[model samples]
Target: MNTQDPLSIGIVGLGNIGRYHAEQLTSLMGSFDIELSGGMDIAPTARDRFESSFGVPTYEDHEKLYETVDSVIITTPNRYHEEYAVSALESDINVLIEKPIAHTIESADRVATAAAASDGVCMIGFHNRFASPVQVLKQYQQQARFGDVHHIEAKYIRRRGVPGRGTWFTEEAASGGGALIDIGAHAIDLALYILDFPQVTEVSGVTRSIFGGRPDYTHLEMWGRSGEGPFNVDDSASAFIRCADGSTISLDVAWAANRPPNNEFVVQGNDAGARLDLSDGDLTIFESSSAGAPHFSDSEVRTRDDDPHRIEQQRFIQASRASEAPTVNTVEQALTVQRVMDATYRSNERGRAVKIDSEPLPTVD
Candidate 1:
């Protein structure tokens, strides 16, 4: 496909995130020479809603949707990621799959293998990496500003933020694990990206289902339908990860907890340290003076107002048009993060640290 031609993009799964992507793509059409080739959702109501809101065609079948567009954005539930992504890749259609790649390492590997064999571009949606502050940190890391990194600490906690308490999110079979696979995936990806995705040597972790199935659990807001259903997933998880380079990472994620909400990523290096507040996208750098005098410097790096989701989509479009892979949000990177997450769950189950033997996958470029 010529880069100059208007790229046609379709969305599969017209759920919350899918709708958001559709809106963003629509907004982007004003600037980019592209076409919103409608969307697909299994639910009839969702399809009707999407078609009514966007005045674009909506299909009940993914194959039909795939036949209409050059690229596909998969916003389906975790369980369906592999199926949709593999199908799209097999059809020579570019794909941008929402994060975690798939619910399990096996499924993620299938998607990765498909991407490796396909000529079309494939990217995982780790939109947090597109944040201005994260971009700056990436720049700093590239320049070796944080020489000899020692460790990274990432937290994506919530006082009460469980989604669909009785829905697919609370079901292990549908959403994989709980907090670790959901928001925790973002934290892990961000930390790994900052650390240049060092191979994880070992992982020790624990998960809890404290709040799920609790009738008294309270939150500022609730997502999806709330009712009596199986809530078998973890509500909180913590993990200690050791990398091949001797650097360590401490990760904590929770959908509901008793503590105050905190969302941040801190990278600690021998020479300098940096912190990114995931809540506001603000980055703070800490450094000591090289002079004899004992002095410290703390600087806050302001972030851009750019919507990360939009930035992510724009890049996906650009890469797809060029038939090139994304440098940051590649399938390999997602696979690495997935491996760490899988290791975390395994460690929790084994009640000890689990050894990670999977080597990093090569990048498409």
Candidate 2:
């Protein structure tokens, strides 16, 4: 990228997510030297809306958009990720793909393989890691403030927030899994990230399709599927993950559950603990202080409220300009998250814990 010229950026899958990134990237044009080259989607209606809304040209195929942009954000459905991402990488175009890397382990493996062989960079969209609180907590962990961090209880629950019954989100073939892949993927990735992306040994999980199949399912809000569609996937999932460093993670994720939603993560360590509200950036640390006799202490960490999506977008463009594969959110790290998701589904089927082999992971050194 020339300093005199802006870094050309593009977006794929002009659905809700695609428009979201376009809006963010557009808002950032004045701050950073970047352009929203164009948008691409298979749907004509979506393309029309994107062009009118953003005033950028739209495409029905990724090939044309790929010819124009240096880097692209693939925010399409999980199944279509591999198609656009691999094509872009082969052309040496950087990609920032959305979470759950691909629809299945095999597809994710192919994407990762392409990233490895290509001269382009690919970063997974686990955008939650860019949140202010998460960054602060990670810094504390690096400082050894949370000594011997052992376990993380990650929860991303919704009392009744299903995307309705007949959408790509509820379709297993398109989405991989329901709540596990949709929201639980974030919980799993964030927990693994906080623990410095530990090596996993085993995973035991149970997936349930409680409310999604019900004809009279009650929900306060639905994100997609206006009327009714095919709902053949799990709506909730629970998993217990075992790590090689004697650390464990208890995961609870649901799109629709009977209990009230609790979107908080509890990080337990030998010396201290923390409770973070996933909705907001409120974080409180729990520790026992030795001053003035042993006693418990609580410290609230207040951080700036910046949009994680915008932050991630800026980082991707900057990193892509620096190296073919910038190490912020590596494809390997996302693959590990995919392995856990894959293992969770397997465990659900076999009714037993599944074992995973540890592998060396790439980092942002």
The residue pairs found clashing in candidate 1 are none
- Candidate 2 residues 162-249, lDDT tens each? 8756888988888888999999989999999999988899999999998888889887677865545688999999999999999999
In model 1, which range of ten residues has the least summed lDDT? 356-365
Q: Positional deviation of 173 in candidate 1, in angstroms?
A: 1.2
Evaluated at residue 141, the lDDT of candidate 2 is: 86
List residue ranges in candidate 1 displaced over 4 A.
1-4, 290-292, 359-365
Query: What does candidate 1's lDDT look like per residue over 1-365, in tens digits?
Result: 56667999999989899999999999999888899988998899999999989888999889999888899999998999999999999998999999889999999989888898898889999999988899999899888888988899999999988988877788889889788999999999999999898888899999988987787877779777775668998899999999988999999999988899999988899889999897977889999995888899998898667899999999998898888887869888898899899998998899999998866574464
| lDDT for predicted candidate 1 compared with the true structure | 0.89
lDDT score for candidate 2 against the true structure: 0.89
Candidate 2 contains a number of clashing pairs equal to 2
Name the TM-score of candidate 2.
0.97
